[model samples]
Target: MHPPGADTVLVRHGDLNTKSNTVKRYMEGLLAENLEAILADRSVPGEVERRWSRPLVHTTEDAVEDATAAAADTFGVVSASPCLTTSTEKDRILEVLAETARARYDGGSFAVDARRADKSLPYDSDDLAREGGAAIWEAVADEFEPEVDLDDPDLTFGVEVREDVAFVYLEKRAGPGGLPLGAQEPVIAMVSGGIDSPVAAYEAMKRGSPIVPVYVDLGPFGGIDHEARAMETVRVLSGYAPNFDMEVYRVPGGETISVLVEEMEEGRMLSMRRFFYRAAEVLAERVDAHGIVTGEAVGQKSSQTVQNLGVTSRATRLPIHRPLLTRDKADIVEQAREIGTFTESTIDAGCNRVAPDRAETNARLEPLLAAEPDDLFERAEEAARNAKLVEP
Candidate 1:
C-alpha cells in the first residue's frame, strides 16, 4: 500500500509497445523524460517512475488532477488515470475497491473490470472482478440501488492486480496517442492562417516530428490580419509541446506571387503553390528536415485538384506530407477545434486578393514545367535566408 495522502497516476503507452525491444526501451526513456517535463511546465509537482512497463506519476492529492491532465496531453500516451494503490491481498483489494467505488460511483448501473497482470495471484481476473463487484455492491447498496451492466454501464470501477500491488481507478482520460515527440526527424511545415494548415502541422507533431513552421508572407495579397492569425495559430500549437521552443519562420513571398500572377494568367495558383513548395525545400535544407507538411486536401480548392497537386509536387524533391489529404473540410475544422487552433483560425483573415476567379484545376505538367522560372531556386534560397524567426 502507498503512503497516506499519496496520489498515483497510471500512464498508458500508445504505440511504443509495437517497437523492437531496443527501440521500445529508448522510446520509453524519452516518454518518461517528456512526461516529467510536461508536469513541470504545467507547474504540477510530481515525480515520475517507471514500473510494470508503464510510467506512474506520484503526486500530492491536490496535484493529481493537473498531473493526470499533463500526462494525457503528452505524446506517446494513450490514456491516464488517477488510481489508488493497494496491496495484492484479496481482502485489501476489495476494501480499497469498495472505498474507491463508494467515493466515485453515485447510484447507477456500474461494472467492475479487473485484470490480473500477475498470474501468481490465487484468483484469476474473473474471480477478482466478481469479488470486487460484490464488495462494491455491498458498500453502495445501503444508499441506493446499484445494477451491474457488463455491456454498458453508467460507472465502471477498474482494478488491476500487479506483482506486489493493485490499482483501482474510476476513469481514464483519453490522450493524443502517437509516438513521442522528437522520435522522428524534424520537418518543415508550411502553415497558413486557415484551419487546415495548423491541424496538418499538429498531426505531424503527433506523429513524432518536431515541426519548423514556415509561414509564407504573401505581402499585399495576404494582409496583416492573415499574418497575425497565422502567428497566433503557431503560438497555440507551441502550447502542445511546452518543453520544445517552437520557432516560427516568416518567409517573404509577395514578390514571387506578383511575378507568377504576371507571368502566367491561368496557371498562377499552381505556380504560387510550386513557389511555396520550393521555398519549403530550401528551408528544409537549412533545418536538415527530411520532409515538408501541408494542409492540402483533395478537391478542397481549385489549386488542390489531383492533377494540380501532382504538378505542384514536382517543384521539390523532398517528400510532401499532406496529413489532411483525404479529410473533409468539416473534419479538418473539427480537428482544428480539438487542437485549440480553430478560434485563432476563425479570425477574419481577408480572402486571397490575388486568386484568379477561375483558377486552373487540372493543369498539365509539360506546359507548367516549361514556364517554371529559371531563378526559382535562387529566389527560394533568398527567401529562406531572409526568413525571420518568431519565437513562441
Candidate 2:
C-alpha cells in the first residue's frame, strides 16, 4: 500500500497555445468536469479551479493517490501531481518544502529542484535549491546515507514558489495529452472487435471528437463473444470521457458479406471494405456527423494498402478520417493498453476468422466499383436504418 499524499493536485496542460481561444476554453472546461466525475466516483470532496495557466484541484491529502490515478485518464492533461501548498513567506515556504522532502526521501541520494516564479522575494532559484536540500539532508542523515547528487538523484523534490503560495511535489503522474472529449465535432467511428480499430477510435476521442461507435456485426461468423468484446472496449474507453454522452450501434453486416462474397469472388474482400465505408457514410448522415472515422493504418494489412484504401473509400465521397493511418501497429497496441482496451480487444472468436487468404493488396478503384452491385448504397442505407443504440 502507498502512503497518504498531499492535499492538492497540480494539473499542467498540453499544447493549448496553438489552439484557438474557444477550443482552449472548451477543453479546459471538459478536463475539469471529467476530473470532477472521477472525484465523485471515489466520494472525494474536491473543487477544480484554474490557477496560473493550469488547473489545481483541492481535495484531502488522503485522497491524492486515488485522484492522481484517476486524473491520468483525462485527456488534455499533460501531467498531474499531488502537492503540498503554503504561503510564500521565505521561511514558511522552506519549512513546508523541507517537511515534504523529509517525508518522501529516505536517505540514499536526493536533490531539490526549485523554480522561482516570484523573483522579488529573497534568494534566487539556485540558492533556494541548496537551502532546501541541506535542510532535508540534515533531517534524514541519521537513518540512511545522504549523498547530494546534483547531476542525477534517486529522489527529486520539485518546488514552484509563486507570489503568494508555493507548490512542492515528488512526482508527476502523466495523462494522455490531447484536446479534451467533445471539443471537436461529433464523428461516427467504425469500431471492430480488434486491437487496431479500438485504439483508432480512442485516438479520435482523445482529439476531442465525441464518437458514436458503429460496430459492423458479422452474423454467425462472430458469436456473442464478438459483440461483448466490442462493447467492453467501449466501456473501458468511457473512462476517458467520464460523463460524455455517446452510444454504440451494432449494424448487421452479414448481408454485405453475402453480396460481395458471391458477386465479386476475385475482389470480394475489397467489396466488403467498400460496404463498410458506405455503411459508415450512411450512419454519419443519420447522426449528423462531420465525417466517418476508421482504424485503418497505412499498409497494416493487404486490405489497408494505399491503393486498397483509395478503392474502399471511393464509395463514400464524404470525408473519412483515419487517425491511425500513419501509425505503426506496435504503437497502436501500446496505446490500446494505456487506454485500457488492449485486454478486451484480445478476446476470443473475432471477425478475422473470415479474412481471405489471398486478399487484394493494391486494388484499383474502377475494378472494385465494377464488381460492386449498383444497389450497394440501398443495402447500406438499410443497414444504417436497422442500427440500434446500446449502452457501452
Candidate 3:
C-alpha cells in the first residue's frame, strides 16, 4: 500500500509473467517506466512501483481516476483496479471491506471475492471471504436484505491480501493485453488512410513493436485528403505510446505508380505492392528496424492473394508482418473502432488510380519480376531518401 489516504491502482501483467525471470524483470522495468511516462504526459501526480510482480500506481484522490485509466490503456497490462488499502489486520480488513461494500452496493445481491497472496497470513482465502461477506451483510442488513450470490452478484467486492496490506476494489478496468512497447525492435509499418492498415499498425504496437509509420503518397492516385487521413490515423496511434514522439515518414510514390502503369497492365497491383515493400525495406534499413508490417490479408484483394503476396514479398529481404493476414474485415473494422481510428479511416481516400480493370490474382515470380522496371530498387531508394517526416 502507498501513503495513507492516497489511491493505489494495482496493475496486472499480461503475457509478461510467462517470460523467464531475466526477461520478465526487463519487461517489468519497461512497463513501470512506460506507466510513469504516461502519468507525466497526462500531468497526473503519481508514482509507480513494482510490488510482488504487479505495478502499483499511487496518486492523490483527485488524480486516481485518470491514473487508473492510464494504467488500463498501457500495453502489457491485463487489468487495472483503483483500490482502497489498509493494514492486513483481520479486524481492519473486514472494516474496510464493509465500508467499501456499503458505498458501492445498494440493495442487491453481493459477493466477497477475496484472495490471499501472502501465505504467511493465518487466514486463507476462504476464511477472508467468509468473514468479509459476513461483515458486509451485517453492515448493509438494516437497509435491505443482503443476499449472497457467488455465481452472479449485482455487486462484487474484490479483496486482495498481500504481505502487510489488504486492498479492496470494486471494478477492474480491462487493458489491452500484450507485451510492453519497446520490448521488441521497431517495425516500419506501411500505413494508409484506410481502416485495415491503421489497425495493422496498432496490432504491431500491441505485439511490443514500437512502430515508425511509413505512408506512401500516391500524388495523383491518392489526393492530399488521403495523406491527411493517413496522418490523422497515425496521430490516433500516437496516443497509445505517448512516451514516444512518433513521426510518419511520407514516401513519394507517384513515380513508381506511373512506372507500373506504363510497363505492366495485368500485374500492376502486384508490381505496386513490390514497390511499397521495397520502399519499406529501405526505410527499415535507415531506421534499424527489424521488419515491415502491412495490412494485407489473404484473398482480401487481388494483390493480397497467397501467390501474389509471395510475389510481392520477394522485393524485400526483411520480414513482412501482416498482422491482419488471417483476420476478417468485420473484425478489423471493430478493432479500428475500438482503437479510435475508424471514423477518420472511413473518410474517402480516392481509390487506386492506377489499378488495372482486372488484376492478376495468381501472379508468378519470374514474369512479374521481369515486368518490373530495372531501376525499381533505385526508385525505392530515392523514395526513401526523399521521404518527409510528419510529426503526429
lDDT-wise, the better of 1 and 3 is 3
- Sort by lDDT, best first: 3, 1, 2
273 Cα displacement, candidate 3 (Å): 1.0
Candidate 3, superposed: residue stretches over 4 Å from native = 1-6
Better of 1 and 2 by lDDT: 1
Higher-ranked by lDDT: 2 or 3: 3
lDDT of 2 at 150: 83
Residue 248 in candidate 1 has what lDDT?
90
Task: For each candidate in the order shown, give its overall lDDT on alpha carbons.
Answer: 0.85, 0.78, 0.86
TM-score of candidate 1 against the unseen true structure: 0.95
The RMSD of every model to the true structure, in order and in angstroms, is: 2.2, 2.2, 2.3
lDDT per residue as tens, model 3, 230-259 = 999998998889887589999999878877
Q: How large an RMSD does model 1 have?
A: 2.2
With candidate 1 superimposed using the best TM-score fit, by how many Å does residue 248's alpha carbon deviate from the native?
A: 0.9
* TM-score of each model, in listed order: 0.95, 0.93, 0.95
Candidate 2 lDDT by residue in tens digits, 294-379: 88888987778898887778878788889999998889889888778999888754446556666778778777677778787787
Which predicted model would earn the best lDDT? 3
